[model samples]
Target chain A: EPEVTQTPSHQVTQMGQEVILRCVPISNHLYFYWYRQILGQKVEFLVSFYNNEISEKSEIFDDQFSVERPDGSNFTLKIRSTKLEDSAMYFCASSKKTETQYFGPGTRLLVL
Target chain B: AQRVTQPEKLLSVFKGAPVELKCNYSYSGSPELFWYVQYSRQRLQLLLRHISRESIKGFTADLNKGETSFHLKKPFAQEEDSAMYYCAFRSYNTDKLIFGTGTRLQVFP
Candidate 1:
């Protein structure tokens, strides 16, 4: 079955540096989303993207976070300034419809 | 606000025993419920959705509107069934999914 794919399975970055997590959602899917799970915490929604624009975002998705669909196949999340608390497993998910999202393997981000 | 609650953080069962992972939700409107699983060293994936009402991998869940719960159950579980399970729900107005804290199931031989 076709699945969502993410690049840089693991990443380590300086606290103040910028980081971009990349994801390629299923080709035919229309809606895309980003979620993060802190170690030993529940997965939390970050943002949702559709039609090249952000559809919804959580309070945690503040000024530092931005999502882009730079190309037809790539969905990227950029953090302007990484904070220690930002370290978590970031998951990318997509669905043809609004329900039943398929998730990627996730990119583990560590901001030291 | 919408929320999902998975009561048990960890559950262990011997092989061939029945297993049930409890999940409860607080949503006023009609909800869309789902069970997602992540096996060791694997990505999180969908196990089943309540809307379909189909059993997957010998697991089935019944949506109880009265109790506002969707508990996943499996009879005579096998060792391979061990994994981390998350109960998730999405409200009708939004596409975002609110996930529970998750329950880790360990089936020992």
Candidate 2:
């Protein structure tokens, strides 16, 4: 089965540095999302994208966060500056319609 | 505001035993419920959704709107059923999903 794929399975960055996480959702899916899970915590929604625009975002997705579909096949999340608290496992997901979301293996981000 | 709640952090069952994972929600509008499973070293995947009203892999869940609950159940637990299960709630207003803390089911053979 076709699944969502994310690059840089694990990332380490200095505090205040910028990092861009990339994802390639299922080719035919229309809706894309970014969610993060703090260690031993529930997964939290960050943002949703459709038609090259953000549909909705959570409070955690503040000024430092931005999402882009720079090209047809890629969906990327950029954090302008990283903080110690920002370290988490980020998962990218997509759904054929708007119901069942298929998640990627997740990218673990560690801030130093 | 919408929230999904999975009260149990861990549950264990032996082979051939029955298992039920409880989930509850708080949402004003109509809600869609889903059960997702993440096995060790595997991506989180959907197990089943209430809308389908169908069983998959001997597992089933019923959406009880009156009780604000959607609990996943299985008749005969198998070793392969061991996984981390998350209950998720999505409102029609938005496609974003709110997930519960999750329940780790350990099925011993």
lDDT of 2 by residue, B1-109 (tens): 5789999999999999999999999997889999999999899999999999989899999999999999999999999999999999999888988999999999998
Docking class of 1: high
Q: Best candidate per TM-score, number?
A: 1
Q: What does the lDDT come to for candidate 1?
A: 0.96
lDDT of 2 at B73: 96
Please report, as a residue range, the 10-residue window in candidate 1 chain A with the lowest summed lDDT.
A95-104
Q: Write the per-residue lDDT of candidate 1 for residues A1-112, one digit (tens) a residue.
A: 8999998899999999999999999999999999999999999999999999999999999999999999799999999999999999999999987767999999999999
Residue A41, candidate 2: alpha-carbon lDDT? 100
Every candidate's DockQ is 0.90, 0.93
lDDT of 2 at B13: 93
Error of 1 at A72 (Å): 0.9
Q: What CAPRI-style quality would you assign to candidate 2?
A: high
TM-score (all chains, Cα) for each model? 0.99, 0.98
User: How good is the docking of model 2, as DockQ?
Assistant: 0.93
